[model samples]
Target: MAATPSASRKRILTYITDDSNRKTTFKKRKKSLVKKARELSVLCGVTVCAVVCSPFREIETEVFPDEGGVREAYARFKGMTQVEQTRRKYSQETITEERYEKVKSKALKVSTGNQEKEMTEMMYQYLSGQLMSLPAMNLVHLNDLAVVTQRHLERITEKLAALGKEGDSVLMPPPPPRAPASMDMGGGMRNDEGNGMYVNTNNRPEGPAC
Candidate 1:
């Protein structure tokens, strides 16, 4: 007598630890599970929801292919989760705001207290002559220092200008010859001589003028 297929096939759950093996097993199991779920839902005509978490805590969903039923279930689940998350977030924000206000108030109070203490010390020093004991400390002394500094700055500027002028004097070119009174044209100068003969300065004859 031949053994039946069901008798040979063992229906037992096995955990796979190897990365590649786990992935292969997960794919096969997921397909089989979804197929079985769909078959059951169609055969029994019942609403079903299935959620699976892999070993890595990643979630996977397999719903009966009924569009309306899947959508309704998803909407309810998502709506509830969103409401809870929003409520928790608002509560956190309220607590944070209260803490911030408390910290801000304390900081202001401490800062004001420090400022008052400093002002009191400064007033006491001003009333006594302790502030005047230091030489060159008063406003008049400061003004005198500023005037002396300004005068020193002016002297330095004058020295720099004098040095620059001396440098320019050393680099000076020879002065050009003054033109004759007749050659001087008030608004425009003519290239030709007043006698109408053109004088080519560039090609001048190598002899003294007659």
Candidate 2:
């Protein structure tokens, strides 16, 4: 289930059009805003002040904590070190942009991982004789599989080139023999009739691998 977005994560924000409603909204938002600033100041031991210009002509400009507080905060800000100034000046837009980039990167990684899994599953299905032909798959899946296969071949080629003929023995050493389940112990070959996979039992098993 998708979680409902919080008030802070509002999808769209616009000014209230109705005069009465706008006035009411302004008052409520201003109160909450001032409350938050006060809480931040008290909790974090920070010097904070808010100055709100009133939309209603009757009401004068509003300053949270008061004019003295604003002046004091301004003086402290001016006296702050460059590092302190930098820490305080990182804007909402900067924070939002960073979060967006992180989310985008994570999403891309997940998408790539899922695509690889799907293509691998398709390849295994074809090899196991579950899928008879390429025509059985959709255009998109077929294209993705082809691309994945090409890349896989390219990677293998790169590895083989790097390793040269020296590591040819290491690349695909030999398949281990499976014990005879039903047939007699002739130390012969085992053919998987279902998938057309063959296993040679003449060679001894090597060190730890499948």
Candidate 3:
């Protein structure tokens, strides 16, 4: 049979007894208190500011400097009419509540209209069973098809040239160079990975990459 082990014992002690431990505790508690203050400011929609000074004279401060709460409290406490007047002027010039609501409503209406139009078109296409079929010729689609044809032609010509090279008796015609952008119906514009149109020429843009 194995012998039984002794039970461990622990005791509670004050943190401030050791100077190093006291300092460490103070640092941790200060950080926790600051975090709690920030959370209170966000959750309760209030502004909070806290300042701490250690025994060695180091000082730290945290401020919630948002629109309401502590700022209003301080303004009221100090009877700062000038500050209130400045705030009112800034708000009027930069962003008024009325203008914000108007812009938001306009954006919402435009987005809803676009979504409805897309949904109606999709439903019509599904019911007609013509979603997969290409219908009604357009300049843009024609230009895309031309580009695809040119790519396939180049591939076929390259294969023929390779075969001719491998068997010296056969001579293959050289593939024609790609047509200039101006000749394409797309007016020199190419689809850049579906993001937007771009000029197909070799010339680089002036600015840095987006």
Q: TM-score per candidate, in order? A: 0.26, 0.52, 0.26
User: What tens digits encode model 3's per-residue C-alpha lDDT throughout 2-88?
Assistant: 544532434444547887778788889788887898898789986566556566446344344434655676766568677765764
- Residue by residue across 83-157, what tens digits does model 2's lDDT show? 998885768799889989999999999998999888977777888999886556678878889998888778877
Error of 3 at 72 (Å): 6.6
**Please, what is the whole-model Cα lDDT of each candidate in the order they appear?**
0.65, 0.80, 0.62
Model 3 lDDT vs. the true structure? 0.62
Sort the predicted structures by TM-score, highest score first. Answer: 2, 1, 3
**Tens-digit lDDT track of model 1 for 37-148:** 8788889987555555465445354445656777876776577766675674557679889889999999999976675565445445655866654343568645644555
Clashing pairs in 3: none
Q: Please report how far candidate 1 places residue 193 from its true position, in Å.
A: 99
Number of the predicted model whose TM-score against the real structure is largest: 2
**Ten residues in a row with the worst lDDT in model 2?**
177-186
Question: Which residue runs of candidate 2 sit more than 4 Å off their true CA positions?
Answer: 1-20, 132-210
